[model samples]
Target: MVKKIASIFGTNMAEPKGETAADRAYRILRSAILSGRLPTDRKVTEAGLAEMLDLSRTPVRNAVGRLLIEGLLQRRKGSGLWCILPTRDEIRTIFDIRARLESYAAARAAEFATPLQRAELVASAARMALLVDEMLSDPHADVVPRIDAENALFHCKIVEAAHARRLELLLQSTIDVNLVTLTLQAYGTEQRMRSASHHHEIAVAIAGGMVELAGKAMEVHILSAASFVLTDPQADHPAPRQGKMPVRPG
Candidate 1:
């Protein structure tokens, strides 16, 4: 079972140490969900997770509670915990919110970003370009998650450059949930990857203090992503599973 979990997450086991069991369980479960190994909307139980992780129920419960707060897990009365699969309407709503927040962030970033922040943004874009090239060369390589992490890092840097704590926290809170679903659906597709590069372009414009271009680029980038999510067949028609909510076809 340990080997199975490691194989699924592309990791090898390490000796347990001072880290809390809840933290360990959360990492394993979160990675499995984001990688699609656990599958969207699948039912989960404390007992099952505890057994699989070779830990007691207490830590599994703690992890589940935290995930529930994060909107990654749903608890159904009389039924058990299951992964949360956002409905089409919910996806649209999330994108709408993201669009507004990210566009504003780009504009603010343009006005407030320091020279060092701008350089960091450029460096991140260069890193993304490198990752994209590597992914194109080797489709089966584990580049998706790496790109996803880097992408988030880039965006976080932009928010920080904006120098608005409230805005940064709001954006940061939603980013993980948004990326988990987006990466699950779009990571391997050529069109999506190309579209993602537009985000890099936007970041460049922002770093150069081009406010209008930065805002427009951000709008275009996010709207393009939303369109991909809405139209992508894989996202709309996830594989069938027993006793879980069905994904609606696009």
Candidate 2:
């Protein structure tokens, strides 16, 4: 089981000190969901996750309840749980909201980023680009998950630089709910490479201090990803009830 999950998620939790068991369980399962390591339709039991995490079922149960409330997981028929996979419309609509927030964030980042912040964002972008190249050069390499992690890091930096707490909170849930995460993994190599290039372009635009260009680049980056999800047959969950973004979903 360890080797199987490692093969899928590429890593495991280290049982960090100072956190409660439920906290640890939540983080582990959330990461697995974002990276698609836990398939959406696969029903999992509390006993299973507790065993997997080397914890009593109590912590796993508590964590599962939290995820259920957050709409990241769903209660199955009878008694079960499954990670929620978003629909095509939900994914696309989330990106639409993301575009509005992040494009403005890029402009603010350009306007506000200190030299050190700018440098760090550029470095992060470079790492994402390198991962894309690595993935493209080797078709079988399990680099998708790594790129997903770096992609989060790279974009989080932009929000950090922007210094907008409200914007960060709004975007964080969107990012965490697997909107951006699922979109990237859904892409083919060409599309992923294009996304990697957009990350580079966003970093360059901000570093160059071009506020408008930075915003435009960010918008284009997110919208392009939304376009991809709209075409996916698997993104076919019942069209989410009318809303620009399902901020809270089930």
Q: Pick the candidate with the highest lDDT.
A: 2
At residue 147, candidate 1 shows an lDDT of 70
Q: What lDDT does candidate 2 reach at residue 88?
A: 62
Residue 207 in candidate 2, Cα distance off native in Å: 1.1
Compute the lDDT of residue 245 as modeled in candidate 1: 24
Question: What are the per-residue Cα lDDT tens digits for candidate 2 across 1-250?
Answer: 2222222222222344687989989978766666555655557777877877788989989999988886788987885787786666666677788788889999999999999989988898889889988887888999877787676667767888897887766664554354554555566788978888998899999999999999999999988877767876556642232222111111
In order of listing, the candidates' clash counts read 0, 1
- Candidate 2 stretches with Cα past 4 Å from truth are 1-19, 31-54, 76-83, 140-142, 173-176, 237-250
User: Residue 240 CA error for candidate 1 (Å)?
Assistant: 9.3
